[model samples]
Target: MPIRFTQSCPTCGRRVQIRASLIGYTVACQHCNAEFVAEASIDDGSGTTDSPIGVEKIAVDPLMARVEEALQRAAKERTAVN
Candidate 1:
């Protein structure tokens, strides 16, 4: 069975449909260029409880991580010198 979920763009609040099978896959928002992943859960028949089917954690881009590290190092060195 195919699962579906909605995700709101962090930048523009645009709603986007995501397939549960695509969980853990990175996708770019067409409206805002923001990247996100899909997560889903199954609703219990009682309609009062839900179970997490899976989580799609967003992966931090390596290039962005490296740049952030460099910036932190530079800031530390500057502070040490001052």
Candidate 2:
């Protein structure tokens, strides 16, 4: 069975076709440089398909944690240096 989905560009409202099987996968919008997941299923009467999965803010959490750790380390290093 072939999977079909719609992906909307974050930068642009342009919609693009994507494969449902590619869910949880990261894909870049051809029109815009925005990247997002190809999840969300949708049925447009013609057939069942997937929609453009919005970019989740999950990766930011880990990145923020790492930044905090680096800042703490830098503070400690500065204190020691002085």
Candidate 3:
């Protein structure tokens, strides 16, 4: 499994997940579509990489999350088709 961590985009300042192995490589931000070198963020223990996304989990509705997952999957399929 690829180890992933969140890093804020330098352009839009939006948090984006970057593979730990991708550090020092060019990566594109999902939110801003800006390209920059990926870096591993130092965890302050406030949100450590040991946990999901380096943060304590926020309780999420299971059904809603499943629906959102389906929607995102469908969107990806649509994008691929185009």
Top TM-score model: 3
lDDT of each: 0.62, 0.63, 0.69
Error of 1 at 45 (Å): 16
Best by lDDT: 3
TM-score of predicted structure 2: 0.44
Alpha carbon RMSD to native, model 1? 11.7
- Of 2 and 3, the candidate ahead on lDDT is 3
TM-score for each model:
0.42, 0.44, 0.52
Worst ten in a row by lDDT for model 2: 51-60
RMSD of each: 11.7, 12.0, 10.6
By lDDT, rank the candidates, best first.
3, 2, 1
Q: Cα lDDT of model 2 overall?
A: 0.63
Clashes by residue pair, model 2: 5-50, 6-50, 6-52
How many residue pairs collide in each prediction? 0, 3, 0
Q: Could you give candidate 1's per-residue lDDT for residues 1-82 as a string of tens digits?
A: 3445766666787877776557768877778888876544454557432454543222235665575578779999999999
**Looking at model 3, which ten-residue stretch has the lowest summed lDDT?**
50-59
Kindly indicate the candidate among 1 and 2 with the higher TM-score: 2
Q: Could you tell me the TM-score of candidate 3?
A: 0.52
Q: What is candidate 2's CA lDDT for residue 31?
A: 83
